[model samples]
Target chain A: MSVLTQIKQAPAANPIERLLLATEADMAKVNALILSRADSHVEMVPELARYLIESGGKRLRPMLTVAAAQLFANGTGTAVNFAAAVEFMHNATLLHDDVVDESDMRRGKPAARMVWGNKASILVGDFLLGQAFMMMVETGNIGALGVLSSASAVMAEGEVFQLAKTGDLTTTAADYAEVIRAKTAVLFQAACEVGAMSGGADDAGRKALAQYGLELGNAFQLVDDVLDYGGQSGTLGKNVGDDLREGKMTLPVILALAEASSEDRETITAALGDAEATADQVAAVVAIMERHNTLARTMEQAQAHARSAKAALEALPGSEMRSLLSEVVEFSVVRAY
Target chain B: MSVLTQIKQAPAANPIERLLLATEADMAKVNALILSRADSHVEMVPELARYLIESGGKRLRPMLTVAAAQLFANGTGTAVNFAAAVEFMHNATLLHDDVVDESDMRRGKPAARMVWGNKASILVGDFLLGQAFMMMVETGNIGALGVLSSASAVMAEGEVFQLAKTGDLTTTAADYAEVIRAKTAVLFQAACEVGAMSGGADDAGRKALAQYGLELGNAFQLVDDVLDYGGQSGTLGKNVGDDLREGKMTLPVILALAEASSEDRETITAALGDAEATADQVAAVVAIMERHNTLARTMEQAQAHARSAKAALEALPGSEMRSLLSEVVEFSVVRAY
Candidate 1:
């Protein structure tokens, strides 16, 4: 049987995992490029950089870039470069985020900052970002470069906005939407947009990919945020209620706060930003979210984004890659189930 | 008298100050661009960014970019954008550096971290860097973008290397050279090279400007290092002996360590990395540096680089700007006197 026929017959495998298998060949090249680019004559740079990059998170962002590129067969090998650049940008942000959040663990391992110290993390993060831009410049595509650079600026702005809103009960759901869009969705939009551009996709294909990626990124983050309060630590690779402890105003909390009674609101506000909050406090906060049906509503919101993500794919001609990307968005939101 | 003759006849005006005056009209546009680009809907970003960018330092790096571009009369107006980008890059580094060093003062003011906090400083620094790259992308000069991006990587590497060498008495002079070159000289080289490119410089003119900027940057940093030990706190915009307390292995310190008696070596090492080192300890270290004439040797080294910087100008056709650039190199080192 042909590979497509066999893929169709594969009944039980998750779409994301299947998509990963489908794009594994191109992704290997991106992975190799990432490893080579992360290297430096300075020993600590590569050492600290690999410590985070090699950590076994799903390489979802780069995979999206690769998969989006593969939606068209006109690849000129620029997608490999863009995929690697996207990964570098993501890793750089992780390094800085750990320092900013004082995170002790990532991907079920000691965070890079925890191992290398905050100073090394900060400088090495800068190094990775510089390398990301270098790879983008090598592509000689000015339009793609403009897209990526704007995403970069918006991501920083999103991060700053999130920092500004931390622990503020007055933060609106609109503000939360803006935060997730800036912090997470913008890069997704840029990645898929540039991927399609590299794949020789015309304007319609690129716009479709961009909209699809943005909605998928929104769904991905909302599910991840819900998981922070409800998923297992082993599955999440982080402690439960980390967002609450860090005072991150995620959607479920925002929704819960808006609907909760004064007593329940007091329960959350007390635990918010309190690093010393006990397990019982976290349980109480989760219970309030449950009482308000916020987690379920958050999952519904994520599902809505996932549906939009799939809807955006209508702009592109039907292909197995496109169908698989559509299913991946469903799989992302369904995880909260 | 003509403007060139008038400039030559001007009595004892600092060449850097004179260059700034010469480029005032163009630089005003660059300054305005910097302010406008730094703005954001996220208010803290613009606030913290301006707090650093508007802080009155020499604006020396941007001035070099503008003057180098002015060497060719065929300016395309891109130099204004490049100049602003260079300033943003410089200011971004300063924000992150202050956080990494836990510094208390910058430009004779409390460091941004002290006023705004490290998290804000870090995120705002990222914002400025993003803005810097955006401005570069707007220029649509991929080659110049490559130059700036590579310099950014090298600067981060230099900072990491410096961190590695901190308090290591065994650090060689070659290592010190590598650190300062990466940290300081590369940006200067890139600034002038891109400026010349924007100004429509020929290959020889670009190469000459790059060499001149590199050597002048070497001389400038050497003088700055010497001043850290010998200049007043009011003049240096930082406490005297701050480098010693931080255990920086600068040129004079390296030289002094090499030639000191064992007793004097003990005094220097004891004070190294001792954040609370007494004024008497700093004086003793300086006294040893004087006994070994290390400060004088460092000044001699600066003078040598300054001369090489001037010699590099021989490749370019002589113009008032070229003459003023050569004089700026001399004036950089003369500050030591």
Candidate 2:
């Protein structure tokens, strides 16, 4: 039986899983391409690379690329390459982000930087990025290349900006928005847009997919920020309060700080960036979040963006792929609940 | 007076200096493009970028790009963009290299990672690389882009290989050759090849330039390895015995190991990667190198590559630019003496 048939015969799958199942065949090709391209005669390059790439994250970004391409019937098979490139790009960022943040764990395992030294992590990340560009160039699509390249620059900027904001209580919600949009949303936008381009998307179709991806990405990050404080470690693949310890001023944090009483504000200010922050400190911060309804408010914002993501599908013709993409956006925010 | 006239009036400006003078006007434009593109409203990106970019080193790789393009009269101005891109690629590597090596000094000053921290260095390096690819795509030259993108992958592989070989006493001359070729020569090859492409070079012209750059790059790195032992800190922009302390099995070390007496071999191996290795230890290692004439032998190898670099230029038509390129090869090896 085909992979899709096998997936269908299994127990009920959620919307995102259903979307993934719908594109499993194409995504399998993408995975193979990623594996082949990630290889090097340099033993450590592939060893460290596979340690992260094969870690069981949802592969949501590449799946978006494939599903977006599936929205049109005119794909020229280049989407497989683009999808793999997107995954490489994402994994590259994760590798570097772990080093920059001094993160010990990723996807519930020791980070690549932890397993390998920081030197190997940095070089392997560079290798993956280099491979990503190679894949993009092989597509022979200059437009897609431009989109991905610009996203890379913007993402780096976002990261640097975030680093600069670390531990600064003055970081505003607008600043947080710019961070998420640049660091996270731009890649999603580029991935879906490139997929559409590979599928021979016209200007309108491409713009529609870009908008859809951007809104969905915003919603996804917003919920991710909420989960850092509200969800279990197993569900989040990381410790609770990681964002707080990293001094990342996510929307919920920004909102709580804005409305916090001086005592509660001091509590957060003391705990922010404290590596030794205890569980009680996290609970205290969550208590402040609850007092301001900041977590729920952030989820409400995510739901709004999710609505906008689904609304972007109106620009494209009605199709099963479009419906699946819309459903995936809703599922992204609903995970927070 | 113009830079060219000043260079001509000097009693004995080196061939490489003369080439820089010949291309001064074009390279100035390329420098401006680099500075402008390196900027970001995010602040730290530009701050860390300029810290390294403005650090005074001869912008040799970018100059090679411009000079190579100057060989042909039928040039589009795309070489300026390519030159800037080449410089960005080199700077990006330097930023990451400092982090990988835990280097404190670069170009006779504190490394960017020292001033801005490793996080900023890595992110800004990524920014520079992203900008480099953007410039390449802006040229709309897919072939040039392919050359650069592939060189990037090879360079990363070379770095990872070097990292793996760290402190490995079994590292062969052949392994060292591959390291330098991948880490250094490939960029030089791509820069010149793309310049030739921008100059509308025929296949033979492109191949000739590629060979010239590869041989010259090999010579350049061989001399660099030798300088770590023989040159002063001021001249080398780093302390003497840095390669030894870093456990890099460069050419001179490889040669010494091959011919050393058991006692001498043990002495050298003990000092390898020894951060606390004393002045006497370094002197002892140098004594072994002198006895075996390994340093001079390494220079002889550099001279051989330099000769080959000049020979490659013979494939091109006679022109002042071609002659200047040939002379620059001679100068690269002479720097060792």
Candidate 3:
């Protein structure tokens, strides 16, 4: 009896957990669709795609899509297709990013590029993108397709823009904000917007959800910035400080640079983008960031974005799904805290 | 008088020129659309995209799209978008292919990867793909979008499949044919098929154009295979024997392996995929292929496919565009002769 109860009563203690519990059945279908679509006659495609997809992602973006549809309380059944398509787009972007960033690990495993080589990783990303569009076309929802497609182009521009600004100490907070919006928030925005459209959302509802996603995405990115500088736990993991090593001008760095002493700036610049920088070098940079309290300021800004995200939820009717969506945004922003 | 005549009478000397002459005004718009859509606020995106787009290869795929659309008298003008989209798709594939093949040159210039780095080339490729889909969505022709999207996926599959069989000595003739069809032919098939669809080709016309494209694509790739092995001029140019060096299981190699002596096989195997394979080594392999007469056999197959391509055009009523298409097919296959 105890074993049966334990198996049946999965914990929903946190907001994401609760959200997951609420959308478990829907996500199961979404998972099935993702797996089926990821299948290909070419053996390496599925092998690489699966290794990445099944590697420990929380499936946050697709869940937002499904939850958005559920919040609308109606759907044309295209929501499932949109949800799966959104996930594919996300995964495709990750595969490309792995190559673009020369990332050796993803979600705590060897990146697909490591397993299959860069060429395979890239071509599989393209294949998944094709499969994504095919699924969207199958829905015959051209409006939603347009939104997602436009978001995709915009997202690429964001990445390129960020690439241009890498290691620029003069990069302002505004620049980081724009990059985060374009490269990070826009995908989240498109996922929710399209999900709402597929779920029969009217103009106002779609706009509100779009705003919600964009703000949530910004908050999500800023918090990630904080985590890279030693989050609320104040412990540096191996993966920590990767952005700095990559010479990325994230919010924490931008905020810290605004007031950094020349000597501190030198310390930061030397370690920045040095592939072989020692851990002590990174920790020294972290110490400067701490002295400036930039991580805390970044967290405050994240909380503000998170608040705006929840405020956007007021535009929609109150429902169990709506609260879960709001809480998920809250859960995401406070994660570093 | 000479200058005026040179400017005025841009001679339509070849079948492709005739097609170009026939579709000049439409292709002008297609070119306009191509340039406009390739424009991105991201500086590197347009810089890299234009470099590849402006390279000296004739705009063959987009021209095919324009010609196919013109073949049908009726049209909704979405063919311009489809043509531009097709070109972007082609360019995007080339950008990706540049990285995948690790080739040093494309259309006689340093590959885009060499100029901007592989990451930029790949991201720009993804950006172009996104732009392609956005243009297609703007047209609201789901059918054409579906065709192009599926082709994109199939083309990637063909590439992956080809990569898998790169050095397999036991690869069959059938495998080579399928790879060429998937990797090379489907884009051509999709180009013409989508064009005919946009142009309002009736069912029979559409089917005929599709068949024509598939066979023509096969011919085109076969000719390319022959060209890689000393082409029509019979001189071992700098680029000759590239396919053998890359260990590509193209038709010439496939057919030659079927009849090679053990000693000849040893020579071919030693040079296959050897990046540092010398002129002497490649010349020795070419000598083996010549004795086996595989290049000629490959050209014969190309001619057969070309004949089949021209025959498919017989289903349509004779017209200037139709004749131009037929001639283009003939002109494509006999390039090596």
Give the best candidate by lDDT.
Answer: 2
> Which tens-of-lDDT digit does each residue in A1-337 have in candidate 2?
4434544554488887887788878988998999999999999999999999999988998888887887776753799999898999899899999999999999999999988989998898888889999999998999999999999899999999999999889999999999999999999999999999998899999999999989988999999999999765567788899889888889988999999999999999888999789889999999999999999999999999999999988999987677778878988988876
Task: Give the per-residue lDDT of model 3 (tens digit) for B259-283.
Answer: 9988999999999988788889989
Query: What does each candidate score in C-alpha RMSD?
Result: 1.8, 2.0, 3.8
* Model 3, position B153: C-alpha lDDT score: 88
Cα RMSD for candidate 3?
A: 3.8
Interface RMSD (C-alpha) of each candidate?
0.7, 0.6, 0.9
Q: What TM-score number comes out for model 3?
A: 0.95
List, residue by residue over B1-337, the lDDT tens digit for candidate 1: 3337646666577897788777878889999999999999998988999888888978888888888888886763798888899998899899999999889999899999999899888888888888899999999989889999999889999999998899999998999999999999999998898989899898999998899989988888898889988764577688888899999999999999998889999999999999999988999999999999988888898899999999999998888888899989988888866
Give the higher-TM-score candidate: 2 or 3. 2
Q: Give the winner by DockQ.
A: 2
**Superposed model 1: Cα runs more than 4 Å off:** A1-11, B1-12
Winner on lDDT (1 vs 2):
2
Model 3, docking class: medium
Ranking by TM-score: 1, 2, 3
Docking class of 2: high
